[model samples]
Target: MAAGTGGRGRRWVTAASPVLLPVASAGLVLTLWWGAVVAFDIPRILLPGPAEVVSELIRLRHRLWEQGLVTLTETVVGFGITTVAGLLLGSAIAASRIVDQATTPWLVAFNAVPKVALAPMLVVWLNLGMQPRIAMVVLVSFFPVVLATSAGLRSTPVELVELARSWDASRWRTFAKVRFPYALPQIFMGLKIAMPLALIGAVVGEFAGGNTGLAFVIRTASAGGNTALAFAAIVVLSLMGIGLFYAVVALERLLLPWVRAVTA
Candidate 1:
């Protein structure tokens, strides 16, 4: 009975650790931040204390919500576009040597260029609208999906391919049964990477030129020397990024329960 109880307790702890650990770590960080601000007499302009930032968050909650929605919409839309385009392109490259040879160099070269440099150009071409922001997100987030998908598809075991062929499976059947499943882990990895990149891309576009978004809030607040408000905006962005990342992780676990079991 005692052993069973102990086992259940351990399982409970394990289950709760994901939530508890982050909360504990955040508490510790906030405590340290508060202590440092109090000890050093840091000016609010230089570094607002956690309390001040929280207060600012409360003050601007509604505005922040609206801006956050705009940013989130841009990120989701852009990531959706990236996922579709990247998968199609990656699959083509992986399946055809001609496509791979023709496109790989260009992809490498384009990815090498700083995305920040492209943001202004997008704004110039598309104007200071949501189109440029979405475009920036696509440009920033598309490469990882393509890279991961192609690599994963290409890395499907030779034996598996042969086994599928031996069974007289059609090309599509083989891919659906074997290659795509094997590639899902990598594809999801690309998606996880792209989610944050999409958020960053939206922010970069906003910084380059925009009157909305959390990034815009941060930019305007900092420019106006409302350091606490800027910090508040940053906090909101951090929360948004964390939420999106975990959503991807949850989807991955849902689709690839076996992967999680193996890793665990």
Candidate 2:
């Protein structure tokens, strides 16, 4: 009886841990921040209290929402392109040794390039528009998805391939049935990494002074020394990242119920 109760307790703890830990950590951070603001009587110009940030967020919610949507749109557009292209390139690499060898050097070199430095060039190449921002998102995010997909596809067991061959399954048939399923989990892992990256890329493009999105709002607020408002914009960006990350997670759960059940 005691063992059974302990098992149930462990299960409950495991089930609750994800949500509880983050909430607790955020609460603790906010408490410390509020305490520091009061104890130091910190200048609002340098740092704003949590309350002030919240108030500013509320005051600017509409404008923030509009800007946020722009960021989200660019992020999604760019990320979608990244995912599709990554899957194609990854499949090619995984399927062909020659293709992998040929592409590796270029992929490594491109990945090594500091994407922030490309913002000005991207703007110059694409002109001063969301096109550059979306391109920025793709550049920053494409590598992970490609690497993950290639790894996952290549990781399919040799025995599975042999068995498929014995059964007279074509290469496409085997990949569709066996390889793709195995790759889904890793692809989603890449996606989680890519999603936040896409958002950051959008902001980076905006920092080049394109005049839209939360990045633009943040730049304006900071230039005017509205630290509270700037902090508020940052808060919105964090929420956006959190929201996007969880959305991908939820989609993963929905699509891969067996993966979730196995992991749990």
Candidate 3:
């Protein structure tokens, strides 16, 4: 029992070490901010102190939660679409050099198009609804997944291919049993990248067209010159992005425990 407790304590200590510097840094920034607010008598419109932001957060907690749900749904739906589409397309391209050659340029072109610029067109085509938001997220996310997974699929060691062939494994068997497993880590890498991109896309779509969400709140707050409220919304958005990113990472760790153990 003592050994188990010691192990957990050590693990906690290890995790805390990495976080300490950031916590200290935040403390310093808040102290300076409070000092500035007092010394300069900074207008709340220009720069609200941390206390005001916290008060606003408490006051608007329920409203923020409702808006957060809308944003979260948009992110999750879009991320799901990108994951399925990317995996399927990546597998297809990886299966055939001809397919890769034919599709690579088109994929590049699609990625090159600035998704933010397409927001207006999306709104026109899909209206100011969840569809446009999800589409934006998918557009922002799919490229990284496809590219990373395809690269991983193609990167199977030649010796591993030869070994599979020596075992008289069919091409499909080789892909299923060998190459795909080898590519799991890279697929997760793409997922990690796409997760945050999905959230950003959703927010951008909301900001450009939607009437609800934290983005809408930010817009209303900024227009009304409620800088504190706008900053609060920004803070919530940042927290959501971070939380989602870590959720993806946790899923990766759970699904690929061997990968984590080996990497660690």
**For residues 1-264, could you state the per-residue lDDT of candidate 3 as single tens digits?**
999999999999888986787688888998999999999999999999999988888899898889988999999999999999999999989988999999999999989998889999999999888999999999999999999889889899999999999999999999999999999999999999999999999998998887898999999998999888888888888889988999988888888889867885
Tens digit per residue, CA lDDT, model 1, 137-243: 99999999999999999999999999999999999999899999999999999999999999999999999998989999999999899999999999999999999
lDDT per model vs. reference: 0.95, 0.93, 0.92
Model 1 segments more than 4 A misplaced: 262-264
Span of 10 residues, lowest total lDDT, candidate 1: 255-264
Cα error of candidate 2 at position 39, Å: 1.7
**What's each prediction's TM-score?**
0.97, 0.93, 0.90
Candidate 1 overall lDDT versus native: 0.95
Better of 1 and 3 by lDDT: 1
lDDT at residue 148 of model 2 (Cα atoms): 92
Task: Give me the candidate number with maximum TM-score.
Answer: 1
- Candidate 3, superposed: residue stretches over 4 Å from native: 1-12, 18-22, 39-41
